[model samples]
Target: MRLRVEFTTEPFDLDEAPAHALAAREVIETAELDAVDVGPFGNTAEGSTDGVLEAVDTLLRKSLEAGATRISLQVSVIGDGNGEGGR
Candidate 1:
């Protein structure tokens, strides 16, 4: 299964993202996934389902340890035509 995961860690200034966001981003980048997207509102990573799940778990724990007050997540299963998703 292929998956895309999106997440955001909060308690950060809009002008400058805090350490939690940075830590989550770092986890995603180092996950060796197929693709990744980092945005103002959140970050997303694409890869095998198991890999994405592992990375998401690591991201959440590390971000919280870095001081995230809240976290939001979305996950999607990629397919050829039909759309399927989760959050």
Candidate 2:
């Protein structure tokens, strides 16, 4: 069960914010039945559904931890192993 996640946060620059986000991603990638590989950096992460959900949770937590005022997230499930990779 794979899915995609797009997340955006309130604008505020913190020196360690991106690292916090990436750390969250790393945690999600290896947590449970999860594996995450980032796509191009336009606010998208695509992978297993469980992984995606976990990653989103991580993202929200990290964003809050980083002092984000707002967090917005979108999710889209990739093709159902339909041989196209949802490209």
Candidate 3:
């Protein structure tokens, strides 16, 4: 199964990347996911179910430790030819 995870850690800053964002990106990159992108609003990563979940878990914990006051997350299961998609 393919998983896509997107998250934002606040308080958001336009001039500099937040510590939580940096921490989350490190975890995602270390996991070697198929794709990872960091944007102004949040970050997104795609990988196998296990890989994505593990990365998400670690990212969440690390983000909090990095002083994130709040975090918003969205997770989805990519299309797999069986009508299970975007959930």
What lDDT score is found at residue 14 in candidate 2?
52
- Whole-model lDDT values for every prediction: 0.84, 0.59, 0.86
Backbone clashes, each candidate:
0, 3, 0
Q: Model 2 lDDT vs. the true structure?
A: 0.59
Residue-level lDDT of model 2, residues 16-40, one tens digit each, is 4464455445555555543345432
Q: Cα RMSD (Å) between model 1 and the true structure?
A: 3.4
Better of 2 and 3 by lDDT: 3
Off by over 4 Å in 2: 14-41, 82-87
Candidate 2, residue 65: the lDDT equals 84
Worst lDDT 10-window in candidate 2: 33-42
What TM-score fits each model? 0.84, 0.60, 0.86
- Model 3 per-residue lDDT at 46: 86
- In candidate 1, stretches whose alpha carbon ends up further than 4 angstroms from where it belongs are 80-87
Error of 1 at 17 (Å): 1.9
Judged by whole-model lDDT over C-alpha atoms, candidate 1 comes out at 0.84
Best by TM-score: 3
Q: Highest lDDT among the candidates is held by which one?
A: 3
Task: Summarize candidate 1's per-residue lDDT along 23-76 as a digit string, tens digits.
Answer: 998899889687798887878888887889999889989999999999999888
